[model samples]
Target: MPSQPDSSQLNNGSSAHRTLSGGGEMGALMRTIDWAKTPVGPVEKWPHSLKTAVRILLDCRLPMYIAWGKEFTQFYNDAYRSIVGNKHPAAMGISAQETWPEIWSTIGPMWVEVWQGQSFGFDNFKLTIERFGYPEDCYFDFSYSPVPDDTGNVAGVLVTFTETTEKVLLQQRLQASADQLTRIFEHAPVGIALLSGPELVYEFVNEPYLELVDHRPVIGKPLRVALPELAGQGIYESLAQAYETGQPYIGRPQMLLKRGQPPTLQHCAFEVVYQPLPDQQGQTESIVVIGFEVTELVKAQREAELANRAKDEFLAMLGHELRNPLAPILTALNLMQLRGTSEVERERTIIERQVRHLVALVDDLLDVSRLARGKLTLKKQRIELAEIIAEAVEQCSPLLEQRHHQLELQVPNTGLTVEADPRRLTQVIANLLNNAAKYTEPGGKVTILGERLDDEVLLWVRDNGSGIEPELLPKIFDLFYQEQQSMERSQGGLGLGLAIVKNLVGLHGGRVTAASAGKGRGSEFSVWLPFALATQAEETLEVIPNLSQPGQLRILIVDDNMDGAEMLATSLSLYGHTIQVAHDGLEGLKAAQSFLPDVAILDIGLPTINGYELARRIRQLPELQKIRLLAVSGYGQQEDRERSLEAGFDLHLVKPVDFVDLNTALFEEQP
Candidate 1:
């Protein structure tokens, strides 16, 4: 039978071991085991070294155990019992194989080595254990050193250990998270960079950041040294400021210098953010850069600006060319209507009407340009709605008669009054009316009706024309939108009439809506205009009586177009006035000094000396000090009118003006 061999080197007999049978729970359980039947048998007669090792194991706060003699019997302290959990008191004096059967197969060889006087050590040693009902993964750091007998041969093993599963698991999860964050940083689409230390040394930069910096190597070097080209740029200073202040900086469409190949420009744009990264103690330790390239967006905006300016110049030249011919035709018509025979007057009427129509189209195109640029202004005033309705009807009646459409009008005797731009209101109503007539078949019935409801006046133009498609009703007022898909339509238009009407109404704080059941069914376009507070209604004259009268006032006409100037002089001469004409500004100034004309009609854009300078020169002469100056131009912008006033003109007139309006302008009253 095996009695416990001496482990004298590990433990000498002490008063502590002599009392071990009832020292603690493990000790109490050990005494209950029948030790004499085991390999390390007979507890009362056990060797002094064995008793000493057991005593020392039971006193430790750290998990420790002693396996004595050839049986490798288990003797463990209270802390070791907790490590084994519910396998506790029953495991106290059990053989190592019996108490730790789950891991005994793996640790048995190591146990044999320790008994043979060899030591075993493990750090974070893994073992699958079934101490509880289910198996669990456990880790430990432990040492199994040989305990020698009094005969000088190894007789037992002493073990000291710690469970390290929780710490190891936590470290694994932290590493996984770090790897995932690193992957995300590498693939991010925007440029990201990190700079550490007060000297602004570059620490990490993603691929996009490298590309933004012209793919120059920058890691582990200060920004100024790495990108020597950035020495004078403000970007380095911005980064430094963010670090020193601990405040973030954001730049939108900020200019940056990226030196390109020799011929290309050095300017680039970016939207960038710089933020400070703080340390655990709350001091800023680094600067992080986040940004995207905005060079394309900046370039696109500048290109658009250039194109718009070019369009404006083209429009100005186009307006001048169109008005030059129209002026001569209008002046010729005035002479024909006053002095020609019946046949001549009839033909002239047709020419005059068509020329005026072309002028209206040109004016509409110009208005569209102004509307798109947000340059149109409304001349708002208090006015009667009924008068505007009647005038707008008269304006559209020619198209209505030509198309052979029947118009039904509904109005109240007491006029609906509103404060608005009367001219724009008239244009709005007339555009709707003309639009109705243009789309309608000959003899289609159209109804134009207006009524007041609460604070609004609703004007409805319902036409039995080819109606709009239901899907297209909402877009009728959009600029350049047309109901017809065919580019060529019999009813000629630039698709601007309704768009202008919409813009004008909106400017007056109102809206326009179009309703149609479907294609081939009639459409209704309605405008809702707000009614202003009523004041005294003044009776407005709806017609202009021909006010031309024979007179002998001397006049001078200066224009670059010879036909326009001579025809206009001829028309003035028909009224018994002596008219002198000059084809250029220099000739006109000479004529003004010689003829001593009472009135001078000047066209802007004359060669040799433009009209503005001529006016100034004419003003300086004592012979023409009191002469009335009338400025005429195809440029009808507000600035054009202001410039005319500054040039000492008494009045300004747009081209293709009615002869009657010209008469009134020349006399400052009815001629």
Candidate 2:
């Protein structure tokens, strides 16, 4: 039996102190503490098991501790000091119950099991502890093993632990982020899909992506197998490239053939992006696909293109058909001048003026068509505004006089110069003046006013006539738009004049606007153009030298219109030139070779062989190789002129051709 030490001996710190030389700060703390006042009494009276446990705990680098004796007196190493935080120094010699009172309910049962000779371990065990002056949730991986006394009975619990709070919380945050991303992808409006492996298996697809493919069961299926219609459409190739190169691939809007629910083939357009998702090794592991459907937009664009093409074709045909009949009427008028008596001179003059007016209307239709297609080009130059106004007035004089309208012109003679295409600008003013003349009642007053307004020139045409309604003002400039007219269309003009005016003005870098005081009042149109600095160069008129009459030469005239051919032949015959007429291309070719004519005037649209083929055939004849070729046609579009010139015509002339121009073509130098 061991005798109890005296109170003096118990209080003697040097007698109880062990030689704990290797431990750091905690070791020093242990040696300094007066264990005589503690539940475990002095250290010297400790059992061998507890003393050995203390030695093991102090020497360890891992966080370790010991609870010895029935009161559970706490002992710990330097590595465990940080876990105790601000309570470390005082907790060094205290009981475990006081050291971790906040977590005693959780850990107390485990300690009791260890006391009963049991060993236990836990991974990520949770506890609430007050380590930093506040109760905080923490996690730990730890084990509790029993230590035996000299009597071979369990007496204490030795604990080895590691704080796992940071690691466990980090894992939880990562899982939460993944869940949020999944929710975002699921609800996205545009198609989103994820594919994995070289097989490009559908790993995930959002609602939109599923709807895009008609809600097919495609998850876990390869992309090629799931959407077989995309087999040869370059979609699979693009995906492969993105995956292999580890670079993102952007797909432009393109037509795609899709298999619909009824197993019908349908056209769809899609714009997509394939982004490669790389692994830890920086190698492409999966691809994320995002796409938008644009089928309706693409379809509308194609339909619009087709409609424009149809419109152009229709206008070209209309121009050709309208001019064919007018050609002969003008030719007959010229024939009358060459051969008729003076008795019907007044009637001929009236017929000729009306024919010319009809020609002007046809020209307006063609001009508007060209402008709408962006094919009309301006020959811009510096010109006086008065000169343009004078030419426009002269063109509109016939209409103005026939309607018995009063005209008032007020424009400054100088200081109103602008850079503009003279011919187009003349057309613009003429169109406005014509509109004013035609729309106003007979003898109504029309006014032309011009002035310089700051940096711009202002010109306006005002009319006291049947003014436009307020609602119709905004739409008057739209092509072919007209207000409610009589069923007979008594106005007798296509609604193209104002549209041409607007387009031509726009081409000149100017703008035109219209105003009216409602129906039955009056209307005014204003044009604004940027003022240009006048140049010092004097305007010169082109002098067309009088052409000397060619000596009598055999001329062949080929036209499908018998009246046109005969009238043109008679007109040339009056000029002392020998003429032969042919009604078709084959007859014309024969006449060129047989007559060996000095010139051949060929009309296109001939029967049997067209004029172009006739020209080639005539050129092939060795005897007629020197004969000059002239093309006459009502189809006078730019492309028609180019085609005629390409087919070897020395000159291409539009119908209602003047005899003076014909004579010039006959003797002018050929290029």
Candidate 3:
């Protein structure tokens, strides 16, 4: 430390300095001070050097504060007033410790150095200063230089500073936001890329985007340079268009070719969109590309289409081949009814029942074909639902008995009516019952319940059987979807029954749904149909007797199939009728004219001519004008029936013709 200075250097001689008053803000503050109460005492009695330093501080336009004497009293110009907002005049006369006590620990050392004649200068120095009764972090570019007295000894420290708190804080906030954005770019699930310049140079690529390009190096390179394989692909052109015209482009499942390890082009399908980014002048500057890879999904869809087509072709062929022999087998059954003994008749009944089931399976396949082509037509009418239920129960009775299912029927006897096709409605309920009976174990309970709601009729078929798998339940009604059959030597079905049920219900503006708790827990299927109210006029219905009247007739049968023709002829002959058979259309036509037959039954497929052409030829024969013509065919589509009617046939019978229906047509003549 230096030796103590002379009294003249500390306080200068009393009354030796002039008053420091001026036109500036600090000058105005000095003019209003009560110098007698301050440590510096009255202005006239202050030291000359202290007075000189105060005058220089007040005259300067820069922000300067003075801590004088031992207390380091706080003093500043108007510019520093805004920095220490709201702490103005009260802070003016206080010591540096009292005015900024919270920050004194940081700045107090600097002041001690200045007072010792050692100067200090700091930039961007941080401190927590208590200015508004609370501590706030702030920064400053300041100096703590010694202020010398007249004898060249330090008397005070001079402070010159500029608060850069706001500027520094703004920069920090901007940097934090940038860091946050970088995190989002790196972790986004979908592919994202940012490109800049006319050539669409890659400025950034995220993790997902890197995977899309096989992790190729693309940053800072033009898109074409990065992926030369995409040159002729539409993607490059689309990108250029959006970049140049500033018009966005979106591509869905567009293929992009990239080279792989084997140098072969690997195609990736992506739903990508190119969005233009504009600069301040509203001109295109960059582009943002966002996309989702859909390659697997697209491939799966294409494969599914091919599979469905294969299934459809298989169904058509299966249905056709199955129907061919059904006609002969059915004819044989009818023949056995009259010739066979009681024991043979019982076996004949079994064969007849099985043949009918096989025909139903074939019919269902044909129905599915019609459904796929959207060519099915419904024959809707108003009828009592109870009548349909009775018919369905009768149809499913054999299967129910075979399975030994305890059947329970819950239905209203009358007044429960619906507008529906009688045949289709009966088929729907019958199918549900059949499926239930087939799937149920012996002694399992099967229930058919019906309830009428406000405007809909709900029919449910429930079974306590080997329940469906949970995963299979959702797709139970889909075409050709069958659950795993148990190991009981049972070929339950071809999986078309429920699909037909769904389609039939849909045609009637209704819906069908299946529910199951899981395997071995049971399943229930519900069909909801719009119901109708029965009027008094509809309450009374006509009763038609099912019995056939006995008649003897001269019949001519034509068919290409020998077994079908011979069996049918024998069955009709047992009805006290004279019958002749011809294997060809021409032979049958000649026989019909010669015999002058009462009825002519013709098969469509003949050797030299079709049944249609034969029917036209037979109609032209004036001698055969009185003969009733019945056309037989395997196809029962509406178009087949119409063609038969147009060919001069009075009635069209489907192949494997029901004997009862055929007898009724023969004996009960058209009105």
Candidate 4:
């Protein structure tokens, strides 16, 4: 069935060497092997097809081998030497089963199929070989092709192969990296999308991005087509600009209308960004869009603005209406006192006290509003702590006397100075004292203590009155918060005093805190202010002297309220000054020109024209230019004061003015 080599071929190694010549390293090894001891016998007696296949394998650069005859003996070239490792010269003439015994179970059947005239091949085929003295898992692209003899019968198996282990592993690693990136994009918090090409086609849309556009099917569709509502909104234009210039476009909160049922417009706001993505060639290729929905935040801000505007309007109206009535009442009381009527003197005093209390309530309401809006400005000056304490004591004396509360004062006489707004500081101290007096029983004791502690000045107000409940301690300084009181509401207040105290103290770079053991156990409030440096000079406090005997001068009073205007004219007339009264701005303007008055006290909300315009018209008259303009109105907000000054007023005073303050305004020199 097979040919065998003659005796000469078996003994001669040189003839076998000639047959395996030209292959690199394995060629030389094959030449020295003794072929007679192998299953295929000597080379000279081998089948013609076997010998021809060996010559072809030795000369080829690709890895190749031949398993011939019944033993399935092996022959391979230099390209296949590394594949067999140390099994070289010995394996040159060994059976395929012995050469790869570790993987024979897998490849042995393949050889049988080839021997039966069938051919087989595989790409990235897995196999375990022991050619290196140990087993190693490897992959290869290999084939088993049958070889035939001169009789055309299956005679041998020819195998061609190349290692593919490294290539396969590299591909697996790249796939893992891609999967990780996909996961990150899908779960991002902000809306994200990738658009490709000049048409701005949506290449990728994450879940957040889908929800931003009302969950419409947008992927693979152009942006213009996906969001038709954005046609004239400049969004599509912005993306195009980013792509063309390779620059990013950042957008602030912009209104976007969503599609909804009933054809009603559902508006929302979004902050968006479009960044251009560049290709390797340094050209813009696509755009990355990132968006954050700000509709709720924007809505909240708008509502806050509207609320503030409404509050400002209400406060203005309340001040004007309330102060209009009180102005005449207070002026009438002053006139009664000036007239020196002993009869009904006690009644007049009571009316004056109640009217002043109402004025304080109105002021507290406006002050809290200004503080909440951060519109109040402080005029800070260096002053001794003792001076501030004395003034606060004087202001609280009236309340303390009414309540019959015993008060104690404990404070350092000197070296405890602070840079602060004197008026605001006095208000803070007075509010604490008033709170203690009102909440305490008639015979309760209240103490005010002050001291210097480590770069700060500490003041404490302790009251042996109705102590605070533990649960309500923290919220005592909240605006409009009041303790539950009897139906009579003996503590007459709007509960804004403590809130004003806290805000004013904070503005001066200080802190305040309240503490109480429990209800009926008395409460203690502490205030700490940063001590001013000793090197700073202390400012001398100016006393507002009485202007009862001020020199007579021409004065004009203009107001829409007839009673307020007439009473103010009578008060100034009693000061031995010439007075003129006008019920409207036009009449006031005409009166100022004809009278050539030294001062014009004008109300803001006047008939015909407002005070601001009246002041402007007065300033326009060349002859009346030197006359002093005073604004007396209920609108005492900082902006209202600024507006009065802008309109050429020398002074801006709130309504229900004190007689002494009015006298000072009439006599004191303007700044």
- Candidates' RMSD to native: 6.2, 6.2, 9.4, 5.9
Cα lDDT of model 4 overall? 0.87
Instruction: Give the Å shift of residue 47 in candidate 1.
Output: 9.7
lDDT of 3 by residue, 1-671 (tens): 01223445435533423355563775666555655567766667656777777777777777888888787766687777777665677777667787777778888887887788887877778887766677789988898898777778887888998888898789779988978877887888998999999999999989999988878999999998998888788878889899889999989786777776776798878799899999999999999999878989989987998888788667665654566578778878877775666778878889998899888988888888878767688877788788999999999888888777899989888767788988899999999998887777888999988898889999999999878888888899899888766687485678999999999999999999999888888889999999887766764444545545566899999988888888888888888889999999889878987888888899886888889998998899988877788987776666777899999888888777887678777744332
Model 1 clash count equals 1
lDDT of 4 by residue, 434-495 (tens): 99998899988999998999999999999998899999988999999998999999898999
Model 2 Cα lDDT, one tens digit per residue, 448-483: 999999999999999999999999999999988888
Candidate 1 vs 4: which has more lDDT: 4
Pick the lDDT winner: 4
Give the runs in model 3 whose Cα sits over 4 Å from its true position: 1-174, 187-190, 196-201, 214-252, 259-266, 273-287, 292-297, 335-343, 361-381, 397-414, 432-451, 458-527, 533-671
Work out the TM-score per prediction: 0.77, 0.74, 0.59, 0.78
Runs in model 1 with CA error above 4 Å? 1-177, 231-233, 241-250, 260-265, 275-284, 292-297, 413-419, 452-456, 485-488, 531-556, 573-600, 612-629, 642-652, 667-671
User: How far off is model 2, as Cα RMSD?
Assistant: 6.2
**Candidate 4 — which residues are off by over 4 angstroms?**
1-191, 197-201, 206-250, 256-268, 273-285, 292-297, 534-545, 669-671
- Which ranking of candidates, highest TM-score first? 4, 1, 2, 3
The whole-model C-alpha lDDT of candidate 1 against the native structure comes to 0.81
Poorest 10 consecutive residues of model 3 by lDDT?
A: 1-10
